[model samples]
Target: MAATAEKVKRGRKFAQVLEGARQVFLRDGYEGANVDEIAREAGVSKATLYNYFPDKRLLFLEVAKAECQRQADEAVEFDDGSAPPDRVLFAAGRRIADFVVSDFGQGVFRICVAESDRFPEIGQEFYRSGPGLVRRRLADYLREAVARGDLEIDDIDLAADQFAELCKADIQTRRVFRLPGCRSGETLDRIVRGAVEMFMARYGVKKGQTKA
Candidate 1:
């Protein structure tokens, strides 16, 4: 299993096939992803794609893992740990909101949900790379904030999870329920601010504290 997984990640055509699989799985999902469509998307022949991945499930899992890692790396790179809790939380919330409403995020989320029962590894990989990683990073910052007296929390993990939900819950439902079109950036900002305010109200060290 490990050997095949490594082979799937390496090779000249692996990058091409991975990107193609990412798109097709996001759009058509696990059960719906077609080999031919993925090949066409990659601008490669079916024979070439098969050289990297013989199993469709393996291909999809690799794609999900790659994409989630890509997003997580970007998040970590831009993250400012020295910032105040409110500022940090707001930034986290904004990033969550942006992804929740994005086409890629929504599609990947659906794939994880739809295939969780059948392909547990795919869902698990997605969580580890995406939400799990994000939550851990948030928890680390929350712990730091608590030490610095910026915030108070008994369970950093729970609070981190709660803050994450708070970021997208208010507005993500519309998208989850298949609401038409994209959400406006202004609307996303409003909800992110509201989430940060609510979180700070519960844990903030200062009263009437504004974002720093």
Candidate 2:
């Protein structure tokens, strides 16, 4: 139908605008990026760009959400609750830590921090799309582990937040501050291992123990 074709065309244009906006935001930072450049880069008219995104903040929010979704989809893969808690948590932690410390992630984070005072909604959007989403997913996993008696969590949500914070440990601060050293895999592994150990120590149950 003509309506369906129009919708498909609009979807493609929307994707194109997002792709261009992402590059602009990454290259120029939120404060420096301009709608004109974004429209030009996306090969769409300024009117079209505005039609899709009313303002740069919304566009940036979309970009941030897309990036978070992509990372979550690619990194956080579990095997139907079959894997051991340590294995699953470690895998998720490592991926999250790595992504948080990556250049792209750092760039996006900096933009949110820098613009938060001027545009508080940007920070809220980033939180909802990024760390908030991750925390919820982790809590779901923890709840499942508790049901299976793999963990003895009193508050799965709190435990999930704590575990995620633990994974950051020394790494996130350094990355945020633009410290000199690189985040090697070994260092990330060590951090995740330590976090998992602490989490398990606190919440892990013995073979026959019930929720005590």
Which model scores highest in TM-score? Answer: 1
Per-residue lDDT for 1-212 in model 1, tens only? 23346657477888988898888888998899899999999999999888888878778767766786787785532234577777777777888888889888889789878988987776777677788888888888888777777787899999988888887865778898887644888888888888899999888877765534
Q: For every candidate structure, what is the RMSD over all alpha carbons to the true structure, in angstroms?
A: 3.2, 5.0
Model 1 regions more than 4 Å off: 1-3, 6-10, 76-82, 180-182, 207-212
Worst ten in a row by lDDT for model 2 = 1-10
Residue runs of model 2 more than 4 Å from their true location after superposition: 1-14, 35-77, 207-212
> What would the per-residue lDDT of candidate 2 be over residues 152-177, giving only the tens digit for each residue?
88888899899989999989999888
Native-structure RMSD, model 1: 3.2
- lDDT against the true structure, per candidate, is 0.80, 0.80
Q: How many backbone clashes does candidate 2 have?
A: 0
